[model samples]
Target: MAATAAGLTGSLLLPAAQAAKPARPLVIAHRGASALRPEHTLAAYAKAIADGADFIEPDLVSTKDGVPVARHEAFLSETTDVAKRPEFASRHVRKTIDGVTHDGWFVEDFTLAELKTLRTIERIPQSRPGSARYDGMFQVPTLEEVIDFLAAQSATVGRTIGLIPELKHSTYFARLGLPLEERVIATLAAHEYTRRAPVEIQSFEVANLRMLREKLGKRANLRLVQLVGVGPVKPSDVAATGGSLTYADMATPAGLRAIAEYADVFAPPTRALIPLKKDGRLDTPTALAADARAAGLRLVTWTFRPENRFLAADFRDGAGDDARNEAGSIAEMRRYLALGLDGFFTDDPALGVKALAG
Candidate 1:
């Protein structure tokens, strides 16, 4: 018990000069202060960096021309003005991605030039009315644009900001002849800043992370993170290949040990670390944190949002589900931090900063 508690912090032996500064958990901005700004925009990334995020996340999807763009998913209907654009009305089509069939305009169906003509919008407008007001105000950004923007933001902020880009639906993209791994790597290598700065490539799929580990080798500033899903869910890649490995299997000590062979970090949804009870209050802490460390993996989770809907029951108040309860949100995070996370993702990085401050 003591060992698990101690190891959960991921405290490392540092040189005497560095030992004076305690290692704090990383504050990762989930889609760039997405609680406020239209996600995956320069405005959102800027807000996150300004609010003191150690890393900003960009979920990568490829366009028809094979260019990687920052978006939450391959589908464009929820997060863009594509549905309202007259020229793109004919582009609507149904396609099965990772087993789910959706009828809508997909990023993979549009070229980068065509995609740039569309603007970003809030995915959940009812919960974030303020963000919805900025609908059609920001352009969908390419990975190159995001990298360049991060480089510029780093210079202007006088701090070393980092990038954590997740290769969304890797298997799906690979099937479309628009495989993202090499293109993303090429883009990263092209940028001088990305070459030197901290770049963590994340994915829910296993093959891509393994491939990245083999192709990139080990780098001082680069890490490969494996994002775990809930329950017996199999990763898209594993599912596509008809493999039987479930995320539940991956959460096991043996599974994590296997993951440690290729990936630097093991990240799952927050509940996987500490599950909630039937009543919505937090249940007993799961052994996931301890198990990951036992397997030689760094621990992290996604995400922490400021709204009551996303808060743990212990933190939510009389305020409705959509209400943004800053105090409750911070409290929820602090409770989880007590379990000794190496890092965490949050929709509002300012609150993450505040939660870390104490």
Candidate 2:
């Protein structure tokens, strides 16, 4: 059966007291209901909550002024109007970052006031035409604004909405002398969410997670997470190659154990959890789950959208990616639940919510 609508039977659907219960495989919104709206915007986050997501995930990047904002990249070229603004043409500069020389409008070059003039756009237009409608509708939002908005939204909705903020390019932010961990911790702490409320901080680098644990102090209830991908380089290489935080660290039992020392969760890419066959069917994922559990860590995989159905497929052959995906989504969610995952990231929260309790 489909899950009850959020407001229709809010109490019956997921009892109020149940909010305090240890989350059982939560359906986290990756940048709000990104499938429905432009990611990281207030509109997207609002839609995620209305669509029944338990948490809204945001990637935090610093502006030129060192102010934390919700954005996936330190550059505005791909997802904002910065490139089109003639006034900021002089701001474009080429720099080698993560191994490649990028010539574009970098976020660090613009102050919060300047960045606000540019509006957000869809990160991937090919997959989502509807999202393009929101192009130029939202300005870069500060983490403070996002936090306050969520706090007020939760009280009004009569349901809890968790936050998962990632410290993007921590090393870079540090080089700029902003020290992302301190800013993130201060922001969450100011909201009384550091330990009392539901919130988690993630980073692709191990050193950053270590820094968070150290700087936040042991008493701080902040949970740290390490995001792993299939890339071969370590966190050390990310600043050099711009490659993902390597799976080389995540796949090893020792790596997981080290992560558990400071991190409560490990959000590996869905590929790490469920290997896709050449024909695009999902293989079993228990091995990876068991490894994380053995290290006293919880697994939280990411980006489970209908378009990425091959990673969730149960059958070798299937229909089109979109049409064949719903079944794959349900099956993959169930499989991950069986593996004792603490949570997962998705662009579609409606299906994810249903799959959570289905």
Each model's TM-score, in the order given?
0.93, 0.85
Alpha-carbon RMSD, candidate 2 = 8.1
lDDT of 2 at 21: 29
Which pairs clash in the backbone of model 2? 98-240, 98-241, 98-242, 99-240
Error of 2 at 167 (Å): 0.3
Model 1 per-residue lDDT tens digits across residues 1-358:
1122122112111111211111789999999989999999989999999999999999999999999999999999999999999998999999888777989999998999999999999999989999999999999999889989999999999998989999999998888899988777777776778766777889999999998776556666777899999988899999999999999999998999999999989999999988999889898899999988888788899999988999889999968999989999999899889888889999999999899888
Please give the clash total of every predicted structure, in order: 0, 4
lDDT of each: 0.87, 0.74
Candidate that scores best on TM-score: 1
Q: In candidate 2, residue 195 scores what lDDT?
A: 33
